[model samples]
Target chain A: MSAAAAAAGLVLLAAVGACAGVVVGAAYVAFMNALRVPARLAALTYTRHMTRIYEAAMAAGAFLAAVWLVFPYTLRLAPAAAGFVGAAMGVYVGMLASALAETIGVIPVVARRTGLGTWVTRLIWFVVLGKITGSLIYWLYPPLVP
Target chain B: MPTVYLKPRDSLIVAPGEDITLGMLAEFAAEDHELERTLRGQPFLPGLTEGHGAISVSSLDLVRAIRRQRQDLDLRIVGPAHTVVKPRVRPNPVMAGIWTAAVTLLLFFGSLMAIMFFHADVDMPLVHRGVYQLVTGEAAPRPLVLQIPYSIGVGVGVLLFFNSLSRRKPSSDPSPLDVQMHIYDQDAQDYLVSQSAAAHRADQARQK
Candidate 1:
């Protein structure tokens, strides 16, 4: 891509990234709430923790935004980049999904017998699986994805 | 008299010998320290002054301390090594944070789909050609390939989700309870106040 084209593409990508940020941020918040045990922690502490998580999630998103903003539009865009992005996001998504199931779903179902510790372990594994799957998908077929 | 939370990653700012306190932390916060843009397992939040209560972050210290904590995350080859991903499990805090990101990604996807589907018949090529000529005076036929990279950019968002898991290295490291101080930012404070008000209202209902 020419410099001018590259610059224009960056501006467009930046706008997209800024717009996508809202979604990524909200998902992080929901995931965090799911991870916590309700009716235990005080509201202030909970908010504090949530704010911390929000900041962290956004910080991570900045990198994503940069990647998007500077995405090489050259037809030579590598397929591996797909896996790289997929693995990062997939792990993140899987982590949130697992947290929702355990904290909200399983916690209510079997909160008594299974310890929080056990739930957390399973959740981590779930996210790891997501990263692996995304990476595999990107490596195998980075172009024209589902 | 006070509790302070110290992470191994905190770089002490006091010259060789000073104390750290809430007031000093506030001053230091205003001058130098701002909230971290992202989350890392190593405690970069509210670092203690090496010698004083001041919160100034010397570049060397922040750099050195955080690196020290991350070193434990390296993978081992032969020796009994803790996996780079630590604690071997998900913490509630981490889980809640991650789910929010996923949901956010989903929402963005929905929006993207809605945009494209809403305009299915629109030839992005024609649009691109028109803009390309207007902007650069180039008569290129395939200026529409510009959208390809942006599409791929979605993967970057996806990658962030995966890295969140790896953000904190698992360790036998205990919570930095040895130090306990809370810094209030406007956003955090506002959230706390709103939640507190909600709790108070709920409590009144329960009492009634």
Candidate 2:
């Protein structure tokens, strides 16, 4: 790519990152609310913490799926760039998706019993998994993609 | 005792110079020194000169202090109170930079893994060969013209999809993320208020 094209590509990627941030940040609110309601109801009661663990798993799965859908585009574009710019952009997308996923899964001790907590927790792990998967796709996908 | 008339409800009177702690705020009954940490630097007490101390201000100053931190308090003094609430301080640059870097790394890893797992599930090579044949009307090789636009379109598509998620045209519509963030902020405010109320109740119970 020419210098101008490369610069434009980077700028485009940056915009993508910003948009991703907004999407993930918005999703995080739902995740936290999920955690909060359960704790409020199960207040001071002794319940198994494993329920919260399960919630975390489910949320993680959702997040992973969401990130997976959005991030593959960057890889498709990587071959267009002359230098590392394309791969860098791919990384940027990956990171953006991952970071958003990370913020969703934390289940507070009080909120552990609620379905929301599990939902949020799963959402968080999903992002983490999504990031890992995205990275692997970028590196391991055949040259046809790059 | 110089009395100051509280606004909205003129029935209320505050006499500054009386020892006032956060516990005296009618709504916030914090334990000793707790208010100092929680509402620190926000002038909750007028004439609070010393450290680890009670706020001893006249009723007018008391009203002034309340107004300083909380303009929505509906409690105002009649006289000129020179209290100017300070703006929130800027975050430390170094700390901000570190946080930004950390977040960036985390995002990178997240996407990396995301692609990996997704690719594992699908047949990307077959998909590529299919697209190549469809675009070129040839065996398995696609030209740069077709490939370039297709790649660029992917980015554009992603943007268009997310922009529409906000339910309005891009650049004009406020992002749904902003709305979600606002909800979280309101939740935090509500949480703080509830905690304070809970603390007050606990204190009252102890006294009873």
Candidate 3:
């Protein structure tokens, strides 16, 4: 692809990833509330989710560095590499805020109630949110899982 | 689902007749009289008013809600954690990133500076002149000021290090209410209280 075309494509991809991250995050919150998990535990799960994103970032860089050594010339694409880093951070922040907001609005209310069936349902929703975030990261970064 | 949350901590217990003001759930318990005699001077029967419903709540959601209640909450924990661990007067992350970039850049800068200072090949292409023009908005190819790149890298590294460090801090004990509930396991606590109470009971029985 032409350099300009590549830049445009990457930019559009970043924007889409960021938008999708927000949507996925919001949907998970709605789903969590419908299940009624306690607010405090929900918040901890959310914080862990954020931590996972940062971990992914550190890992991605290490992987990329390894790949660059293998592929050689690819390392010279420094600007594009930096841009990808920025995009990941941007997407992470977007999704994280949306997810937390959902938790803030609903988790506290859920904490007040009682029931085992409801608790089980909430657990499923927590996993769903985590999966959504993970999928989004995969789509954007494409983990090098050799 | 109702969202009231019990802050799960190390300390605190609630029995049916424990609350004098009936704050957590004694207020909700139907039969107060049946439990009154057993609850007297129970020392500390403080159980969560928020209750067990939030049992399914993920740990993150709980923190977010508590966090919102007090910004100080995060600052108390992560901020302090970072501060305490920070080396007494070393280069921070932001400085480090800049330094790495700067040092790399300086090497290149020194080479070019040597060229300018001594290897001033007058016959060389006006490329350097073009660089000058571009940089100064005149007609020049200014020597790639290698120092600039190093400084920029150093600046960026330091910025990143500090940003991450800030997040690593110990956030607030927003709910100073937390330490009391979580610091001890419930059974150990119950044993302690019962041991003290048992001594009192034995003393009373002896008087009889």
DockQ of each: 0.03, 0.06, 0.02
How much is B52 displaced in model 3, in angstroms?
14
Q: How does residue B74 of candidate 2 score in lDDT?
A: 43
lDDT of 2: 0.40
TM-scores of the candidates in the order shown = 0.23, 0.36, 0.20
Worst 10 residues of 3 chain B by lDDT: B78-87
**lDDT of candidate model 3 versus the reference:** 0.33
Of the pair 1 and 2, which is ahead by lDDT? 2
lDDT of 1 by residue, A41-91 (tens): 223133545655655665675555445445622323344343344344333
Q: For model 1, what is the error of residue A85's alpha carbon versus the real structure, in angstroms, after optimal superposition?
A: 2.0
Residue range B156-191, candidate 2, lDDT tens digits:
322321232234443454332333444554465455
Give the per-residue lDDT digits (tens) of candidate 3, residues B22-104.
12211112134443322222222233243331111123433453445434322111111000000112235675555445443
lDDT of each: 0.37, 0.40, 0.33
In candidate 1, stretches whose alpha carbon ends up further than 4 angstroms from where it belongs are: A1-77, A105-108, A111-146, B1-208
Candidate 1: true interface contacts recovered:
0.01
lDDT of 1 at A105: 36
